[model samples]
Target: MGLLDNMKARIGPAKEKVSHLAQRHGGTIGHGLERAAKLVDEKTKGKYSDKIQAGTGKAKEAMDRLAHRSGRSPEKGEAPQAGETPRSASPPSSPEGPPPVS
Candidate 1:
C-alpha cells in the first residue's frame, strides 16, 4: 500500500480511540476548559474577554458533541426549575425583519 494509505489505516483507530476518550471524560474535560478560561481571563485582567469567551464557547460545543456521540444528553431531563429561562421564551433577534443584507 502507498504511504498515505498506510498512514490513514494506522491513524483511523487512533482517531476513534481519542473520540471515545473524549466522550468518556467529557465532563472533566469541560470543567478543565472552564477553569482554564477563567484563569486566562483573570491573568489578562479581562483584556481578552471576547476571545476568551469565544474559546470557552467552542470548548463547550466540542464537549457537547462528544457527550452526544456517547449517548448522553447535553442536559439531563430537568425541567426549567426555579429561575431558568425556557428556550422558546427568549426573544428572537430578528423576528420581523430578514437578516442583514451583506
Candidate 2:
C-alpha cells in the first residue's frame, strides 16, 4: 500500500479508540480542555489569549465530531447523556410577520 494508505491503516484502530473514549468521557475531556486552556492563558498573562481561545474552540469542535451523537442533542463541547436522542438543529419558527412595538 502507499504510505498514506499504510498510515491510515495503522491509525484506523487508534482513531476508533480515541473516538470511543471521546464518546464516553466527552464532558470530562471538555472540562480538562477548558481548564488547560485557562491555565495556559493565566500563565501567559493573556498575551496569547485570543490564539488560545481559538485553539480551544477548535479542539472542542473536534471532540464533538468524535463523540458521534445518536439521538438527543448534546451541548457544545459535551457528550450526549445516556438514552438521550441526538438533538436536531431545529430553529424556532418566526411567529407572524413582524413583532409589535415594545
Candidate 3:
C-alpha cells in the first residue's frame, strides 16, 4: 500500500474514537466553547467582537459536523430553515476572478 493509504488506515480507529467522544460530549463541548468565547470577548472589551463571534460560530459548526449532529446539517432531500444557509453553499463565483490584493 502507498504511504498515504497506510497512514489513513492507522488513523481510522483514532478518528472513529474521536467521533464517538464528540457525539457523547457534544453539548458539553458546545457550552465550553461559548463560555470561552464570552470570556475572550469580555477580556477584549468587544474590540474584536465580530471576528470572535464568527470564529466561535465556525468552530461550533465544525464540532457539530464531527459529532454527526443532524440538526446543524441539512440532510439529503431536506431544505434548510428560513434565513439559514447550508454549509455546502458558497458565494457566487466572480467570472472576473479574485480581486487584486492591495
Candidate 4:
C-alpha cells in the first residue's frame, strides 16, 4: 500500500478514540474554549476581540464536526442552526445585474 494509505490505516483507531471522547465531552470542551477566549480577550483589553471570537467559533465547529453530533457533516449536508448563516451561502445578488458600461 502507499505511504499515505498506510499512515491512515494506522491513525484510524486513534481518530475513532478521539471522536468518541469528543462526543462524550464536547460540551465541557466547548465551555473551556469559551472561558479561555474570554480570559484572553479581557487580558488584551478587547484589542483582538474579533479575532478571538472567530478563533473560538472555529474551534467549537471543529470539535462539533469531530464529535459528529446531530448527523452534521459535509457529506451529510449540514443545516445552519438558528441565527447562523450557512457557510456555503452566497451574498445576495443584485437584481439589476451588472452595472451599465460608461
Estimate the TM-score for candidate 1. Answer: 0.59
- Runs in model 2 deviating more than 4 A are 69-102
Q: Which rank order by lDDT, best down to worst? A: 4, 2, 3, 1
Tens-place lDDT per residue, model 1, 1-102, is 999999978877776676788878888988899899999999999999999989898778866655455533225554543333454555656657776788
What is the C-alpha lDDT profile of model 4 across 1-102, one tens digit per residue? 999999978887778888889999999999999999999999999999999999999889878777874333243357755435677778997878788889
Off by over 4 Å in 1: 66-102
- Give per-residue CA lDDT, model 2, range 22-102, as digits (tens): 888999999999999999999999999999999998888878867774323357757545444446636788898788888
Point to the candidate with the largest TM-score: 4
Residue clash pairs of candidate 4: none
Q: Candidate 1, overall lDDT?
A: 0.72
The lowest-lDDT stretch of 10 consecutive residues in candidate 4 is 69-78
How do the predictions measure up, each by TM-score?
0.59, 0.59, 0.67, 0.68
Candidate number that wins on lDDT, 1 or 2: 2
Scored by lDDT, the top model is 4
